[model samples]
Target: MDEAIIVDAEFVAPVGTTAGEFVPIDRAPAAGLLLLVAFVVLYAKVISKLGKPAIQEFLWEIITRIVPSKQLRRRKEAQLRAIEVHTQRSNTSSQDQFAKWAKLDREYGKLKVEIEDINNSLTASKARFFTIISSAIFLSTTGMKMFLRIKHRKAAIFWLPKNAFPYPIEYILSFSSAPLGSVSVSAWLMICDAAMDLIVTIFVALVVGVIGMLRSNKVKPKTA
Candidate 1:
């Protein structure tokens, strides 16, 4: 009988992989999702900080530049200039020139009404434009997020150790048919968004605190 040789070999997990679990070879999708969630969270924070009116005004300016209604704007400007000229003429004319002054005042009134109409038209157009753009943006972002979640519904970002948490907590992490003890796409997205929001809040608080301290120091009186 031939003697069998047994060699003891220690098992080593691949670098960047857990000891017992096999990690996905391509982590791009998970990583990209994380980055996307973080960016969205950060952008929301920035928009809140800037204030909605400020952002709306900024967007409106951009829209005006891109979709210029030069003719309407020019007409409004000319009407305003004519109104100014009529006021100057009326002011200089004496009671002896009552007819001329009255004619100028009537022209001014017509110009005012025309300008008001132009303003209303412009406001209505802006409202419609903003509505369309906002709807498109909301739909695109929501659709993309839904697609990603559905595509990666069963995929685990990473696995937790068995019994890492209580049953309820584990179930929550493995939500929507994901395997137990693993974080699903939806869970990971929520985690990333929460983490990013926390980080941004902390950073803003730190910056504000530093600025306050510097301002206080600048105004403080030095004791001899």
Candidate 2:
């Protein structure tokens, strides 16, 4: 029992380290781990977003399939009644039929406008949600990359370009007992990189918004 316990103790290494004495796995800091997780989750989310149309279509099919027979019959009957009424109106005197059709056309135009407004509102809501998610993802990646630079004295996954005129960014320190300390030149570079990322994200979002506005204007329905 003692020998078994001793052997098990040898295998149990510190958290984030190699299990055995001979085997060495570099212990990644919490910041690095966070960055890795953030990248993975974000990548998966983007993929899911790309596939949303297909998923929605599949769900719609299932809903249609599972609709109650009585409800389906009622819908079919309503469609037939609408067709009958339209046919009756069409068979009336030519002038009367034309007047009726004009009224119906105006009503249809109004309904279409209402539907378009609803769709635009829904799209705006979705855009806001996407913006929030994207901002959170970007901030996490940038902040963690900077934290790793300060903690590990290593080159982060992303870094900023050297300044035209070099400045002393090293020697900055944190008085608080934080996991990320030892601020140096590299840390400042990481901070600069994060700022650049924020600017780029905002610019890209603005460009996208402009493109969306142009597209909507181009495709807007002409009023009769």
lDDT per residue as tens, model 1, 17-55:
543464333322456655665565566565545455665
Model 2, stretches more than 4 Å misplaced?
Answer: 1-94, 151-224
My TM-score estimates for the predictions, one after another, are 0.66, 0.31
Cα-based lDDT for every prediction: 0.68, 0.48
How many backbone clashes are present in model 1? 0
Q: Indicate the TM-score of model 2.
A: 0.31
Report how far residue 3 has shifted in candidate 2, in Å: 44
Model 1 worst lDDT run, 10 consecutive residues: 1-10
